[model samples]
Target chain A: MILSEREEEWMTAYQNGDEDALERIYTLLKQPIYSFIFRCTRDEQLSIDIVQDTFVKLQRYKHHYNPKHGKLKSYLFQTAYRLMITKLNRRKKWRSLLPFLAPLQQSEELPHSDRMTIREAVARLPDIQRAVVLLFYYHDMPQEEIAQILGIPIGTVKSRLHAAIKKLKKELEGGYNESGSL
Target chain B: MSQDPFKQDRHLRTKLDEYHVDVPDFPMKPSRWIRFINLLASPAKDPLDPLISTPSGLILLKIAPIIGTAVVTLIQILMFL
Candidate 1:
Protein backbone atom coordinates (compact mmCIF):
# COMPACT_ATOMS: atom_id res chain seq x y z
CA MET A 1 0.00 0.00 0.00
CA ILE A 2 1.13 3.50 -0.78
CA LEU A 3 2.17 5.40 2.34
CA SER A 4 0.10 8.48 3.07
CA GLU A 5 1.91 11.71 2.29
CA ARG A 6 2.07 12.44 6.02
CA GLU A 7 3.82 9.14 6.79
CA GLU A 8 6.27 9.73 3.96
CA GLU A 9 6.85 13.27 5.16
CA TRP A 10 7.29 12.10 8.73
CA MET A 11 9.86 9.55 7.59
CA THR A 12 11.70 12.15 5.52
CA ALA A 13 11.76 14.65 8.36
CA TYR A 14 12.65 11.90 10.84
CA GLN A 15 15.55 10.75 8.66
CA ASN A 16 16.77 14.34 8.69
CA GLY A 17 17.04 14.41 12.53
CA ASP A 18 13.74 16.00 13.46
CA GLU A 19 12.72 15.10 17.01
CA ASP A 20 9.14 16.23 16.41
CA ALA A 21 8.97 13.95 13.40
CA LEU A 22 10.18 11.04 15.54
CA GLU A 23 7.46 11.75 18.07
CA ARG A 24 4.86 11.85 15.34
CA ILE A 25 5.98 8.50 13.97
CA TYR A 26 6.04 7.06 17.48
CA THR A 27 2.46 8.20 18.09
CA LEU A 28 1.31 6.68 14.84
CA LEU A 29 3.00 3.29 15.30
CA LYS A 30 2.95 2.78 19.06
CA GLN A 31 -0.34 0.85 19.28
CA PRO A 32 0.57 -1.83 16.79
CA ILE A 33 4.10 -1.82 18.20
CA TYR A 34 2.75 -2.29 21.70
CA SER A 35 0.46 -5.04 20.45
CA PHE A 36 3.40 -6.84 18.92
CA ILE A 37 5.52 -6.52 22.06
CA PHE A 38 2.64 -7.28 24.43
CA ARG A 39 1.89 -10.45 22.53
CA CYS A 40 5.49 -11.51 23.06
CA THR A 41 5.98 -10.51 26.70
CA ARG A 42 2.34 -10.88 27.88
CA ASP A 43 3.04 -8.41 30.71
CA GLU A 44 1.25 -5.14 30.05
CA GLN A 45 3.63 -3.04 32.17
CA LEU A 46 6.78 -4.73 30.90
CA SER A 47 5.65 -4.35 27.31
CA ILE A 48 5.01 -0.65 27.81
CA ASP A 49 8.44 -0.14 29.30
CA ILE A 50 10.09 -2.09 26.47
CA VAL A 51 8.19 -0.11 23.85
CA GLN A 52 9.42 3.14 25.41
CA ASP A 53 12.98 1.87 25.52
CA THR A 54 12.67 0.77 21.88
CA PHE A 55 11.76 4.28 20.73
CA VAL A 56 14.65 5.73 22.74
CA LYS A 57 16.98 3.32 21.00
CA LEU A 58 15.49 4.40 17.70
CA GLN A 59 16.12 8.03 18.56
CA ARG A 60 19.69 7.36 19.70
CA TYR A 61 20.55 5.23 16.68
CA LYS A 62 18.51 7.30 14.26
CA HIS A 63 21.64 7.88 12.24
CA HIS A 64 22.05 4.16 11.60
CA TYR A 65 18.61 3.73 10.00
CA ASN A 66 18.52 3.15 6.28
CA PRO A 67 15.20 3.77 4.56
CA LYS A 68 16.20 1.66 1.55
CA HIS A 69 16.46 -1.68 3.30
CA GLY A 70 12.83 -1.95 4.53
CA LYS A 71 9.80 -0.14 5.80
CA LEU A 72 10.17 1.90 8.99
CA LYS A 73 7.45 -0.26 10.60
CA SER A 74 9.49 -3.42 10.16
CA TYR A 75 12.60 -1.75 11.52
CA LEU A 76 10.69 -0.47 14.53
CA PHE A 77 9.29 -3.93 15.28
CA GLN A 78 12.73 -5.53 14.94
CA THR A 79 14.27 -2.99 17.32
CA ALA A 80 11.42 -3.45 19.80
CA TYR A 81 11.89 -7.22 19.77
CA ARG A 82 15.59 -6.82 20.46
CA LEU A 83 14.93 -4.48 23.36
CA MET A 84 12.22 -6.83 24.69
CA ILE A 85 14.66 -9.74 24.65
CA THR A 86 17.17 -7.72 26.67
CA LYS A 87 14.53 -6.75 29.23
CA LEU A 88 13.34 -10.36 29.49
CA ASN A 89 16.90 -11.51 30.11
CA ARG A 90 17.26 -8.97 32.93
CA ARG A 91 13.93 -10.14 34.38
CA LYS A 92 15.27 -13.67 34.35
CA LYS A 93 18.22 -12.51 36.46
CA TRP A 94 15.89 -10.79 38.93
CA ARG A 95 13.73 -13.90 39.11
CA SER A 96 16.79 -15.87 40.18
CA LEU A 97 17.40 -13.43 43.02
CA LEU A 98 13.85 -12.95 44.31
CA PRO A 99 12.49 -16.39 43.34
CA PHE A 100 9.13 -15.30 44.71
CA LEU A 101 8.12 -12.52 42.38
CA ALA A 102 4.61 -13.61 41.41
CA PRO A 103 4.22 -14.90 37.91
CA LEU A 104 2.61 -12.32 35.59
CA GLN A 105 -1.17 -12.48 36.00
CA GLN A 106 -2.66 -14.15 32.96
CA SER A 107 -5.63 -13.07 30.89
CA GLU A 108 -9.06 -13.84 32.37
CA GLU A 109 -10.29 -17.25 31.31
CA LEU A 110 -13.52 -17.17 29.39
CA PRO A 111 -16.27 -19.80 28.98
CA HIS A 112 -16.06 -22.04 25.89
CA SER A 113 -13.79 -19.50 24.25
CA ASP A 114 -11.50 -21.29 21.83
CA ARG A 115 -9.49 -18.29 20.71
CA MET A 116 -9.06 -16.74 24.13
CA THR A 117 -8.08 -20.09 25.53
CA ILE A 118 -5.54 -20.65 22.77
CA ARG A 119 -4.15 -17.17 23.25
CA GLU A 120 -3.86 -17.75 26.99
CA ALA A 121 -2.23 -21.08 26.32
CA VAL A 122 0.21 -19.43 23.97
CA ALA A 123 1.04 -16.85 26.63
CA ARG A 124 1.94 -19.68 29.00
CA LEU A 125 4.42 -20.99 26.45
CA PRO A 126 8.17 -20.56 26.83
CA ASP A 127 9.50 -17.25 25.55
CA ILE A 128 10.84 -18.38 22.19
CA GLN A 129 7.69 -20.32 21.36
CA ARG A 130 5.51 -17.41 22.44
CA ALA A 131 7.51 -15.05 20.25
CA VAL A 132 7.35 -17.35 17.26
CA VAL A 133 3.61 -17.95 17.71
CA LEU A 134 2.69 -14.30 18.04
CA LEU A 135 4.91 -13.23 15.16
CA PHE A 136 3.29 -15.91 13.04
CA TYR A 137 -0.38 -15.64 14.00
CA TYR A 138 -0.64 -12.04 15.16
CA HIS A 139 1.62 -10.43 12.63
CA ASP A 140 0.53 -12.84 9.85
CA MET A 141 4.15 -13.11 8.84
CA PRO A 142 5.39 -16.17 6.99
CA GLN A 143 7.99 -18.46 8.49
CA GLU A 144 10.79 -17.13 6.31
CA GLU A 145 9.96 -13.54 7.21
CA ILE A 146 9.83 -14.48 10.90
CA ALA A 147 13.23 -16.17 10.62
CA GLN A 148 14.73 -13.06 9.04
CA ILE A 149 13.14 -10.80 11.65
CA LEU A 150 14.21 -12.93 14.63
CA GLY A 151 17.66 -13.77 13.14
CA ILE A 152 16.93 -17.47 13.39
CA PRO A 153 17.18 -20.06 10.64
CA ILE A 154 14.03 -20.89 8.71
CA GLY A 155 14.29 -24.43 10.05
CA THR A 156 14.20 -23.19 13.61
CA VAL A 157 11.20 -21.04 12.82
CA LYS A 158 9.41 -23.98 11.25
CA SER A 159 10.14 -26.23 14.22
CA ARG A 160 9.09 -23.67 16.81
CA LEU A 161 5.92 -22.87 14.86
CA HIS A 162 5.11 -26.54 14.52
CA ALA A 163 5.61 -27.14 18.22
CA ALA A 164 3.63 -24.06 19.13
CA ILE A 165 0.73 -25.12 16.94
CA LYS A 166 0.78 -28.57 18.52
CA LYS A 167 0.67 -27.07 21.98
CA LEU A 168 -2.24 -24.82 21.01
CA LYS A 169 -4.05 -27.83 19.58
CA LYS A 170 -3.72 -29.68 22.85
CA GLU A 171 -4.96 -26.72 24.84
CA LEU A 172 -7.95 -26.17 22.57
CA GLU A 173 -8.91 -29.84 22.71
CA GLY A 174 -8.70 -29.95 26.47
CA GLY A 175 -10.74 -26.80 26.83
CA TYR A 176 -13.29 -28.15 24.33
CA ASN A 177 -13.57 -31.50 26.09
CA GLU A 178 -14.43 -29.82 29.37
CA SER A 179 -17.00 -27.54 27.75
CA GLY A 180 -18.45 -30.40 25.59
CA SER A 181 -18.62 -28.13 22.55
CA LEU A 182 -16.27 -25.98 20.51
CA MET B 1 2.63 -30.66 6.17
CA SER B 2 -1.01 -29.87 5.43
CA GLN B 3 -1.92 -26.89 3.31
CA ASP B 4 -3.92 -25.61 6.24
CA PRO B 5 -3.66 -26.75 9.80
CA PHE B 6 -6.87 -24.80 10.28
CA LYS B 7 -8.68 -27.11 7.85
CA GLN B 8 -8.33 -30.07 10.19
CA ASP B 9 -9.63 -28.18 13.22
CA ARG B 10 -12.07 -25.98 11.22
CA HIS B 11 -12.48 -22.98 13.55
CA LEU B 12 -8.85 -22.96 14.65
CA ARG B 13 -7.51 -20.13 12.48
CA THR B 14 -10.51 -17.87 12.93
CA LYS B 15 -10.53 -18.48 16.66
CA LEU B 16 -6.80 -17.85 16.92
CA ASP B 17 -7.36 -14.30 15.76
CA GLU B 18 -10.17 -13.62 18.25
CA TYR B 19 -8.44 -13.13 21.56
CA HIS B 20 -7.74 -9.44 21.25
CA VAL B 21 -5.26 -8.03 23.75
CA ASP B 22 -5.43 -4.41 24.79
CA VAL B 23 -2.21 -2.74 23.73
CA PRO B 24 -1.98 0.51 25.66
CA ASP B 25 0.04 3.37 24.22
CA PHE B 26 3.26 3.72 26.15
CA PRO B 27 3.51 7.16 27.77
CA MET B 28 7.00 8.57 27.39
CA LYS B 29 8.41 12.05 27.14
CA PRO B 30 12.04 12.36 26.27
CA SER B 31 12.64 13.57 29.87
CA ARG B 32 15.12 16.38 30.73
CA TRP B 33 17.70 13.80 31.76
CA ILE B 34 17.25 12.16 28.37
CA ARG B 35 17.47 15.49 26.60
CA PHE B 36 20.63 16.34 28.49
CA ILE B 37 22.05 12.97 27.55
CA ASN B 38 21.04 13.31 23.89
CA LEU B 39 22.61 16.73 23.89
CA LEU B 40 25.81 15.42 25.42
CA ALA B 41 26.20 12.43 23.12
CA SER B 42 24.64 14.07 20.09
CA PRO B 43 26.99 14.07 17.11
CA ALA B 44 28.40 17.40 16.00
CA LYS B 45 26.19 18.24 13.07
CA ASP B 46 28.43 21.19 12.14
CA PRO B 47 29.86 19.72 8.94
CA LEU B 48 33.18 21.32 9.98
CA ASP B 49 34.06 20.09 13.45
CA PRO B 50 37.87 19.72 13.02
CA LEU B 51 38.14 16.69 15.28
CA ILE B 52 35.86 14.87 12.85
CA SER B 53 36.42 16.30 9.36
CA THR B 54 39.79 17.98 8.66
CA PRO B 55 42.78 16.05 7.23
CA SER B 56 45.20 16.96 10.07
CA GLY B 57 42.56 15.94 12.54
CA LEU B 58 41.94 12.75 10.57
CA ILE B 59 45.66 11.98 10.67
CA LEU B 60 45.70 12.59 14.42
CA LEU B 61 42.74 10.21 14.73
CA LYS B 62 44.57 7.55 12.71
CA ILE B 63 47.82 8.12 14.66
CA ALA B 64 45.91 7.47 17.90
CA PRO B 65 45.96 3.71 17.29
CA ILE B 66 49.69 3.55 16.48
CA ILE B 67 50.51 5.76 19.46
CA GLY B 68 48.40 3.57 21.71
CA THR B 69 50.22 0.42 20.51
CA ALA B 70 53.67 2.03 20.93
CA VAL B 71 52.90 3.19 24.48
CA VAL B 72 51.68 -0.26 25.48
CA THR B 73 54.81 -1.89 24.01
CA LEU B 74 57.09 0.62 25.74
CA ILE B 75 55.42 0.03 29.08
CA GLN B 76 55.81 -3.74 28.66
CA ILE B 77 59.47 -3.43 27.68
CA LEU B 78 60.23 -1.14 30.64
CA MET B 79 58.52 -3.56 33.00
CA PHE B 80 60.67 -6.44 31.67
CA LEU B 81 63.90 -4.40 31.91
Candidate 2:
Protein backbone atom coordinates (compact mmCIF):
# COMPACT_ATOMS: atom_id res chain seq x y z
CA MET A 1 0.00 0.00 0.00
CA ILE A 2 1.62 3.25 -1.21
CA LEU A 3 0.53 5.93 1.20
CA SER A 4 0.33 9.46 -0.12
CA GLU A 5 2.82 12.02 1.19
CA ARG A 6 -0.08 13.81 2.86
CA GLU A 7 -1.04 10.58 4.63
CA GLU A 8 2.51 10.13 5.81
CA GLU A 9 2.50 13.70 7.08
CA TRP A 10 -0.67 13.02 8.97
CA MET A 11 0.91 9.99 10.58
CA THR A 12 3.88 12.06 11.66
CA ALA A 13 1.66 14.80 13.02
CA TYR A 14 -0.39 12.18 14.85
CA GLN A 15 2.70 11.00 16.66
CA ASN A 16 3.37 14.60 17.66
CA GLY A 17 0.10 14.75 19.63
CA ASP A 18 -2.02 16.33 16.95
CA GLU A 19 -5.55 15.16 17.66
CA ASP A 20 -6.88 16.45 14.34
CA ALA A 21 -4.23 14.52 12.49
CA LEU A 22 -5.17 11.42 14.38
CA GLU A 23 -8.81 11.93 13.43
CA ARG A 24 -7.90 12.44 9.80
CA ILE A 25 -5.86 9.25 9.86
CA TYR A 26 -8.81 7.45 11.41
CA THR A 27 -11.22 8.77 8.77
CA LEU A 28 -8.88 7.86 5.94
CA LEU A 29 -8.33 4.29 7.14
CA LYS A 30 -11.62 3.25 8.78
CA GLN A 31 -13.53 2.26 5.69
CA PRO A 32 -10.84 0.09 4.10
CA ILE A 33 -10.18 -1.65 7.41
CA TYR A 34 -13.91 -2.07 8.05
CA SER A 35 -14.58 -3.47 4.58
CA PHE A 36 -11.69 -5.93 4.81
CA ILE A 37 -12.71 -7.14 8.27
CA PHE A 38 -16.37 -7.36 7.24
CA ARG A 39 -15.53 -9.43 4.17
CA CYS A 40 -13.30 -11.72 6.23
CA THR A 41 -15.52 -12.18 9.31
CA ARG A 42 -19.01 -11.77 7.72
CA ASP A 43 -20.18 -10.31 11.01
CA GLU A 44 -21.13 -6.64 11.02
CA GLN A 45 -20.97 -6.06 14.79
CA LEU A 46 -17.72 -7.92 15.18
CA SER A 47 -16.29 -5.99 12.26
CA ILE A 48 -17.22 -2.67 13.86
CA ASP A 49 -15.76 -3.77 17.18
CA ILE A 50 -12.56 -4.85 15.51
CA VAL A 51 -12.33 -1.56 13.62
CA GLN A 52 -12.68 0.35 16.89
CA ASP A 53 -10.09 -1.87 18.49
CA THR A 54 -7.74 -1.25 15.57
CA PHE A 55 -7.92 2.51 15.99
CA VAL A 56 -7.51 2.21 19.74
CA LYS A 57 -4.42 0.15 19.12
CA LEU A 58 -3.16 2.78 16.71
CA GLN A 59 -3.52 5.46 19.37
CA ARG A 60 -1.76 3.34 21.96
CA TYR A 61 1.08 2.47 19.61
CA LYS A 62 1.25 5.67 17.58
CA HIS A 63 5.02 5.89 18.01
CA HIS A 64 5.40 2.55 16.29
CA TYR A 65 4.15 3.98 12.98
CA ASN A 66 7.16 4.83 10.83
CA PRO A 67 6.99 5.23 7.07
CA LYS A 68 10.58 4.01 6.81
CA HIS A 69 9.59 0.63 8.21
CA GLY A 70 6.43 0.21 6.07
CA LYS A 71 3.23 1.93 5.07
CA LEU A 72 0.93 3.02 7.88
CA LYS A 73 -1.91 1.32 6.05
CA SER A 74 -0.12 -2.01 6.28
CA TYR A 75 0.59 -1.43 9.97
CA LEU A 76 -3.11 -0.83 10.63
CA PHE A 77 -4.07 -3.90 8.62
CA GLN A 78 -1.53 -6.04 10.51
CA THR A 79 -2.98 -4.96 13.85
CA ALA A 80 -6.54 -5.65 12.71
CA TYR A 81 -5.54 -8.98 11.22
CA ARG A 82 -3.94 -10.15 14.44
CA LEU A 83 -6.98 -9.03 16.45
CA MET A 84 -9.36 -10.72 14.02
CA ILE A 85 -7.46 -14.01 14.17
CA THR A 86 -7.44 -13.93 17.96
CA LYS A 87 -11.16 -13.17 18.10
CA LEU A 88 -11.93 -15.94 15.62
CA ASN A 89 -9.81 -18.43 17.56
CA ARG A 90 -11.55 -17.55 20.82
CA ARG A 91 -14.96 -17.93 19.16
CA LYS A 92 -13.91 -21.31 17.74
CA LYS A 93 -12.87 -22.49 21.19
CA TRP A 94 -16.19 -21.38 22.67
CA ARG A 95 -18.14 -23.09 19.90
CA SER A 96 -16.30 -26.30 20.65
CA LEU A 97 -17.27 -26.11 24.31
CA LEU A 98 -20.93 -25.24 23.75
CA PRO A 99 -22.28 -27.21 20.82
CA PHE A 100 -25.77 -25.76 21.02
CA LEU A 101 -24.66 -22.17 20.44
CA ALA A 102 -25.10 -22.11 16.70
CA PRO A 103 -22.89 -19.94 14.54
CA LEU A 104 -24.41 -16.72 13.18
CA GLN A 105 -26.12 -17.23 9.82
CA GLN A 106 -24.61 -14.31 7.92
CA SER A 107 -25.82 -15.53 4.55
CA GLU A 108 -29.47 -15.09 5.41
CA GLU A 109 -28.95 -11.37 6.05
CA LEU A 110 -27.49 -10.64 2.62
CA PRO A 111 -29.71 -9.64 -0.29
CA HIS A 112 -30.05 -11.99 -3.24
CA SER A 113 -28.00 -9.76 -5.52
CA ASP A 114 -25.02 -9.87 -3.17
CA ARG A 115 -24.94 -13.66 -3.11
CA MET A 116 -22.38 -14.40 -5.80
CA THR A 117 -20.73 -17.79 -6.27
CA ILE A 118 -17.26 -16.22 -6.05
CA ARG A 119 -18.05 -14.62 -2.70
CA GLU A 120 -19.31 -17.91 -1.32
CA ALA A 121 -16.24 -19.73 -2.59
CA VAL A 122 -13.97 -17.13 -1.07
CA ALA A 123 -15.73 -17.44 2.27
CA ARG A 124 -15.27 -21.22 2.25
CA LEU A 125 -11.49 -20.88 2.16
CA PRO A 126 -9.41 -21.40 5.31
CA ASP A 127 -8.64 -18.19 7.24
CA ILE A 128 -5.06 -17.67 6.07
CA GLN A 129 -5.82 -18.34 2.42
CA ARG A 130 -8.83 -16.07 2.57
CA ALA A 131 -6.65 -13.28 4.02
CA VAL A 132 -4.03 -13.76 1.29
CA VAL A 133 -6.64 -13.66 -1.48
CA LEU A 134 -8.44 -10.64 -0.09
CA LEU A 135 -5.25 -8.66 0.44
CA PHE A 136 -3.90 -9.55 -2.99
CA TYR A 137 -7.04 -9.14 -5.11
CA TYR A 138 -9.45 -6.93 -3.22
CA HIS A 139 -6.99 -4.50 -1.64
CA ASP A 140 -4.66 -4.51 -4.67
CA MET A 141 -1.70 -5.28 -2.44
CA PRO A 142 1.42 -6.79 -3.96
CA GLN A 143 2.71 -10.19 -2.84
CA GLU A 144 5.70 -8.61 -1.05
CA GLU A 145 3.54 -6.25 1.02
CA ILE A 146 1.16 -9.10 1.81
CA ALA A 147 4.10 -11.11 3.09
CA GLN A 148 5.30 -8.19 5.22
CA ILE A 149 1.85 -7.73 6.77
CA LEU A 150 1.28 -11.45 7.36
CA GLY A 151 4.89 -12.10 8.48
CA ILE A 152 5.40 -14.89 5.94
CA PRO A 153 7.89 -15.40 3.13
CA ILE A 154 7.06 -13.97 -0.30
CA GLY A 155 7.15 -17.50 -1.75
CA THR A 156 4.56 -18.66 0.78
CA VAL A 157 2.31 -15.76 -0.16
CA LYS A 158 2.54 -16.69 -3.83
CA SER A 159 1.75 -20.35 -3.15
CA ARG A 160 -1.13 -19.53 -0.83
CA LEU A 161 -2.58 -17.19 -3.46
CA HIS A 162 -2.24 -19.81 -6.17
CA ALA A 163 -3.74 -22.50 -3.95
CA ALA A 164 -6.59 -20.21 -2.95
CA ILE A 165 -7.40 -19.35 -6.53
CA LYS A 166 -7.40 -23.03 -7.47
CA LYS A 167 -9.67 -23.85 -4.56
CA LEU A 168 -12.04 -21.03 -5.48
CA LYS A 169 -12.16 -22.17 -9.09
CA LYS A 170 -12.87 -25.74 -8.11
CA GLU A 171 -15.56 -24.74 -5.67
CA LEU A 172 -17.22 -22.28 -8.02
CA GLU A 173 -17.21 -24.81 -10.87
CA GLY A 174 -18.95 -27.41 -8.66
CA GLY A 175 -16.12 -29.97 -8.76
CA TYR A 176 -14.94 -29.72 -5.18
CA ASN A 177 -13.07 -32.97 -4.93
CA GLU A 178 -11.63 -32.97 -1.42
CA SER A 179 -8.10 -34.40 -1.64
CA GLY A 180 -7.28 -33.51 1.99
CA SER A 181 -5.33 -30.44 0.92
CA LEU A 182 -5.77 -27.29 2.97
CA MET B 1 -9.63 -25.96 -17.31
CA SER B 2 -8.92 -24.04 -20.52
CA GLN B 3 -9.75 -20.67 -18.88
CA ASP B 4 -6.74 -18.63 -17.84
CA PRO B 5 -6.44 -17.82 -14.11
CA PHE B 6 -5.80 -14.19 -14.96
CA LYS B 7 -9.12 -14.11 -16.76
CA GLN B 8 -10.71 -15.60 -13.65
CA ASP B 9 -9.05 -12.90 -11.58
CA ARG B 10 -10.57 -10.23 -13.79
CA HIS B 11 -13.95 -11.93 -13.48
CA LEU B 12 -13.62 -12.07 -9.70
CA ARG B 13 -12.62 -8.42 -9.59
CA THR B 14 -15.70 -7.50 -11.58
CA LYS B 15 -17.89 -9.52 -9.25
CA LEU B 16 -16.29 -7.90 -6.23
CA ASP B 17 -17.04 -4.47 -7.72
CA GLU B 18 -20.74 -5.25 -7.90
CA TYR B 19 -20.99 -5.85 -4.17
CA HIS B 20 -20.83 -2.90 -1.76
CA VAL B 21 -20.45 -3.38 1.96
CA ASP B 22 -21.73 -0.49 4.02
CA VAL B 23 -19.25 0.91 6.54
CA PRO B 24 -20.76 1.87 9.83
CA ASP B 25 -20.04 5.26 11.40
CA PHE B 26 -17.74 4.98 14.43
CA PRO B 27 -16.82 7.88 16.66
CA MET B 28 -13.16 8.16 17.60
CA LYS B 29 -12.61 6.76 21.07
CA PRO B 30 -9.92 8.54 23.14
CA SER B 31 -10.01 6.22 26.11
CA ARG B 32 -6.58 4.87 25.30
CA TRP B 33 -5.01 8.29 25.83
CA ILE B 34 -6.77 8.66 29.13
CA ARG B 35 -5.44 5.27 30.21
CA PHE B 36 -1.89 6.24 29.24
CA ILE B 37 -2.08 9.49 31.19
CA ASN B 38 -3.42 7.60 34.16
CA LEU B 39 -0.52 5.22 33.97
CA LEU B 40 1.92 8.14 34.06
CA ALA B 41 0.14 9.97 36.89
CA SER B 42 -0.45 6.94 39.07
CA PRO B 43 2.11 5.90 41.69
CA ALA B 44 4.14 2.83 40.87
CA LYS B 45 3.47 -0.19 43.09
CA ASP B 46 6.73 -1.92 42.17
CA PRO B 47 10.07 -0.06 42.53
CA LEU B 48 11.10 -1.21 39.01
CA ASP B 49 7.82 -0.08 37.45
CA PRO B 50 8.81 3.60 37.43
CA LEU B 51 12.21 2.79 35.92
CA ILE B 52 10.63 0.73 33.15
CA SER B 53 7.76 3.14 32.53
CA THR B 54 9.64 6.28 31.47
CA PRO B 55 12.56 6.94 29.09
CA SER B 56 14.49 9.11 31.58
CA GLY B 57 14.39 6.36 34.17
CA LEU B 58 15.82 3.95 31.61
CA ILE B 59 18.71 6.35 30.86
CA LEU B 60 19.36 6.83 34.58
CA LEU B 61 19.42 3.06 35.03
CA LYS B 62 22.01 2.70 32.25
CA ILE B 63 24.45 5.38 33.73
CA ALA B 64 23.89 4.74 37.43
CA PRO B 65 26.86 2.35 37.85
CA ILE B 66 29.25 4.74 36.03
CA ILE B 67 28.09 7.63 38.22
CA GLY B 68 28.59 5.50 41.33
CA THR B 69 32.17 4.57 40.28
CA ALA B 70 33.08 8.22 39.50
CA VAL B 71 31.75 9.38 42.88
CA VAL B 72 33.77 6.70 44.72
CA THR B 73 36.99 7.74 42.89
CA LEU B 74 36.38 11.44 43.70
CA ILE B 75 35.92 10.61 47.42
CA GLN B 76 39.19 8.62 47.47
CA ILE B 77 41.11 11.51 45.80
CA LEU B 78 39.64 13.98 48.35
CA MET B 79 40.77 11.66 51.21
CA PHE B 80 44.37 11.63 49.82
CA LEU B 81 44.30 15.49 49.70
Give stretches of model 2 more than 4 Å off: A1-3, A100-116, A174-182, B1-9, B30-81
lDDT of 1 by residue, A1-182 (tens): 35534665787798786878987888887887788887776667666766787788877787776766666777777888888888767756855665444233344232455434765676667778878878777776667667767889988988887787887877777666666553
- Interface RMSD of predicted model 1: 14.8
| Cα distance off (Å), candidate 2, residue B7 | 5.5
CAPRI tier for the interface of model 2: incorrect
Find the 10 residues in a row with the least total lDDT in model 1 chain B: B39-48
List the TM values for chain B, per candidate.
Answer: 0.40, 0.40
Q: List model 2 lDDT by residue over B1-81, tens digit each.
A: 112344646545565565568997767663566545643553323546678789999999989999999999999999999
lDDT score of residue A104 within candidate 2: 45
Off by over 4 Å in 1: A3-9, A100-116, A178-182, B1-9, B30-81
Give the share of true interchain contacts found in each model.
0.22, 0.24
Q: Please state the error at residue A101 of candidate 1 in Å.
A: 6.8
Residues A89-115, candidate 2: write the lDDT tens digits: 876785577533435446434444322
Error (Å) of candidate 2 at residue A78 is 0.2
Interface RMSD values, listed in order for every candidate: 14.8, 13.6
TM-score of model 1 relative to the true fold?
0.66
